[model samples]
Target chain A: NAGVTQTPKFRILKIGQSMTLQCTQDMNHNYMYWYRQDPGMGLKLIYYSVGAGITDKGEVPNGYNVSRSTTEDFPLRLELAAPSQTSVYFCASRGTGPNTGELFFGEGSRLTVL
Target chain B: AQSVAQPEDQVNVAEGNPLTVKCTYSVSGNPYLFWYVQYPNRGLQFLLKYITGDNLVKGSYGFEAEFNKSQTSFHLKKPSALVSDSALYFCAVRGGGSQGNLIFGKGTKLSVKP
Candidate 1:
């Protein structure tokens, strides 16, 4: 099964540009998340969804927006790209069961803002 | 706020030697901790987790972690390291809540030399 899938494995953007990073999970998970990994820094949460139509901001949600219209999809949108946004982005999903906290992550989407 | 910390930026060890990656957490209530490994250009993979029951939680790749309530630390350990084990390790924590969002540390680079 494709636990989680992210589109556009790598991309290059210019300042003030806008783009969407698409994420999908086929495992029927109830929770989905978006995280960015900067060099020498661990993953920083941007946004997350507990279930369809229920999204919330995470630790570093500035300059980012997310939508979860379906249980299988959670997409992150960047309205205006900046150099600081040039990092590897990861999408993860997990079930709602208390015993099922292990997150299944996508390969990653490397973005470069020049 | 709940958070996790990986004190070391990098850890080096001989291939056959024992290895340890230190992690500490700060939270108000019982903590649900986890360890994940990420290879170059790859996504994070779940190693193990500590919710309750035992303090010594064994995970994939022969890795284990000890949860110390007094110290508020969860240190990952392996008896014998392998060169193939060289990667980035992350420690994460989730507090008591229905929301399944995890707070991750900066990550530690594990370098196993042959």
Candidate 2:
């Protein structure tokens, strides 16, 4: 399987600009998540979706928005981007099952807000 | 709230020697723990996870972790380190009772010197 894939490997956004980070998984996972990793810091959760049409806020979801319109796609949107939003973004997906907590992550999209 | 901690910011070990990266966690109930490794400028890759069963779980690339419930620790270990193993390692945890968010540690950088 292709597992998880993310588009726009790198980007630079002007302050207040908006953009969407695309993510897709071929594993048919029910859970998808977005996370941001700052320099020398652990990844902080941004948003997640348990299934299509079911999105939820995560620990650091304040400046981000997400939508899971299809079973294979979960896109993270950053509106009014700020310098603080400069970080590496990762998308992950995991299949359904009681003990299926194993997450498959994408290649990541590095963004810098200037 | 659940959280993960990696006590060391960086760990240095010589090639062919044993290496260990310590991790500890805090949560109310049973925990689902995981380990991921990230190479320079690359996204995190799943190594292994411990949801239940054996205390010692082996994972990718000759890596293994011991899950100690009483001590609330899951330290990554490898018998003989390789220079290729030098990378950033992160520990993550999520509570078992609910679909709690996965929490991650600050991350530990391992440098295997020849």
Candidate 3:
């Protein structure tokens, strides 16, 4: 299984531009999440979806949006990019069972904003 | 607020010696703690988790962690470090029983010198 996959491994954007970082998981997981990794800042949650058609804002949700149309896809949208948005983005998923707390992560997408 | 902290920015250890990466967390109730590793320019990989049961949790790549409830810490350890063990390690905790709301610490870079 492809566990989790993220598109556009690397991207560059100018301030105010917009784009979507696509993420898909084949694990049939009920929970999916988006996280941004900045140097010395660790990983901050941006958004997450419990299931299809259910999404919620995370700790660092400002400037980002997300939609979960199907169980397999959870895409992150940057409406108006800024320099602060330049970071490595990762998508992750995990099962709903009480014992399944560990997350399976994607390869990550590197974004650079000017 | 739920949070995770890796006290050391970097840990240096000699090959064949033991190593420990310290992590502490703050959250209400029993926390679901996890450890993940990331190589340079790569995504995070699951290492271990502590949800319930035994306080000592073993995970991938021959790594183990002890969950100290009183201390609210999960320290990753290895009996014998290897050069290949050099990477960025992260500690995380589930936030408020939400839908996969995981909070991560500023990663600790592990360096094993030969």
Which order, best to worst by DockQ?
Answer: 3, 1, 2
Q: What is the TM-score of chain A alone in each candidate?
A: 0.98, 0.96, 0.98
Candidate 2 to truth, TM: 0.96
Q: Tens-digit lDDT track for model 2 on B1-114?
A: 788999999999999999999999998778889999999888889899999999999999999999998999999999999999999999999744344457789999999999
Most accurate candidate by DockQ = 3
The fraction of reference A/B contacts recovered in model 1 reads 0.76
User: After TM-score superposition, what is the CA distance of residue A66 in candidate 3 from its true location, in Å?
Assistant: 1.3
- Residue-pair clashes per prediction, in order, are 1, 0, 0
How far residue A65's Cα lies from its native spot in candidate 2, in Å, is 1.1
Q: Rate residue A98 of model 3 by lDDT.
A: 62
The pairs that clash in candidate 3 are none
Kindly list the per-residue Cα lDDT of model 3 for residues A1-114, writing each as its tens digit: 788999999999999999999999988998999999989998888998999999988889999999998999999999899999999999999898768888899999999999
If the candidates were sorted by their TM-score against the true structure, best first, what order would they fall in?
A: 1, 3, 2
Better of 1 and 2 by DockQ: 1
**A84: Cα error in model 1, Å:** 1.4
- Report the poorest 10 consecutive residues by lDDT, candidate 3 chain A: A94-103
TM-score per candidate: 0.97, 0.96, 0.97
Question: Over the stretch B1-114, how does candidate 3's per-residue lDDT look in tens digits?
Answer: 788889999999999999999999998778899999999988999999999999999999999999998898899999999999999999999887667667889999999999
